[model samples]
Target: MDSEESRCFSGYDGNRFKLVILASQRAHELSSGAATMVDRQGDKNTVVALREIASNQLDLSTVFGLAVQRCRKYLEEFAGSRGIAGHSSHVSPSRSSRHTGLGKSFVDNKSTYSASFLDQDKFLSGGKDDGIKGF
Candidate 1:
């Protein structure tokens, strides 16, 4: 599990330091009642946040703010080389919780990720509850 988790730290161009900072910020958001951008999968907020970044399931702008513009050059190059128009969005577990009352399991057969969960503007302006911070 350590190896798997370590691989997640490389998601941000192998800059583990930056990845850690971003994950912590994302975890703070989760702990503050903001919906997750990815399935929780029984992991704590920190772990889930790490996995989200590792999988490119997160929009970098959400955590890094204006700093993301500087990083986008690399990402755009990587995406272009791989023929990816953009990162694919992942399903958040919140929708499933509505049907099963079990936030960790995927209960809805036709579940879709909420756009609100991926709102890039929320980090700086505060999230749905106005309690989440940008950094």
Candidate 2:
């Protein structure tokens, strides 16, 4: 049984740390009310633990996969809550967010960008009198 145990312990492709963690978890579960898959006539918990490890009952990759799924769910929930907590506007912002010298009505009723609505007199006279910065 020692050779078989060594073979099982060494056959694991992943890190030994992960394997020990998973095996210890499985042993705890087995010692609890969890059902055992292999035959258990007069087996001790150590034998059962080794057999469980050898039989591929507890896979580190599968455990990591489940943990990843749970982490993703938790992160998504956190992000969603943050979005709701910090969210303010369902409608669009005002046209003058920055200090741009333009008003809501500077563009015509059609859109914010109107090709024919040029302030040509202000530009040609070169005076500081656009009167949009007063607001």
Candidate 3:
């Protein structure tokens, strides 16, 4: 029977794919009837440790992929819960200010626009060769 410490040590490998496989195997063995109850309990501990190792091994890209997947799944459920169709969250052209001239305030520069909008507005302002036009 593997000690709890040994199971934990087995998960310290730098490769996450191997850790996930190890965890899955442990989980299966723990849930199976082949081991004594005490050994099974130890396997369960190993399984948990392996899962933690797998999660820790995930790089930023992998984490981001998982986050995006989760967001897509839950966003549909969230929309449905709010009495809206999941697919109805489309980006409507009418809802965008680009075509509506709602961005005019920032472009005209009569009032100071927030810094976040300054860069895009500057591009829309045409070349610096043109003098500042008042609203």
Top model number, lDDT: 1
* TM-score on alpha carbons, each prediction: 0.42, 0.38, 0.24
lDDT of 1: 0.55
Residues 36-83, candidate 1, lDDT per residue (tens digit)? 877787889988888777777777765765334434554456445644
Q: Which candidate, 1 or 2, has the higher TM-score?
A: 1
For candidate 3, the per-residue lDDT at 90 reads: 41
lDDT by residue for model 3 (1-135), tens = 247545656745343433343454444443554332232343455555354444454233333334334445554565446444323244355654455554343333423233232233332334452223332
Model 1, total clashes: 0
* Model 2 agreement with the true structure over 9-120: per-residue lDDT tens digits: 6755544444454556566667776687677657776577668767866654554444335444654575455442223232135534663444333222223222221233
Q: Judge candidate 2 at residue 91 and give its lDDT.
A: 17
Q: Number of clashing residue pairs in every model? A: 0, 0, 0
Best by TM-score: 1
How would the candidate models be sorted by lDDT, starting from the highest?
1, 2, 3
Model 1 misses residue 31 by how many Å? Answer: 0.6
In the predicted model 3, the residue pairs found to clash are: none
Report residue 10 deviation for candidate 2 (angstroms).
Answer: 3.3
Give the whole-model CA lDDT for all candidates, comma-separated. Answer: 0.55, 0.49, 0.41
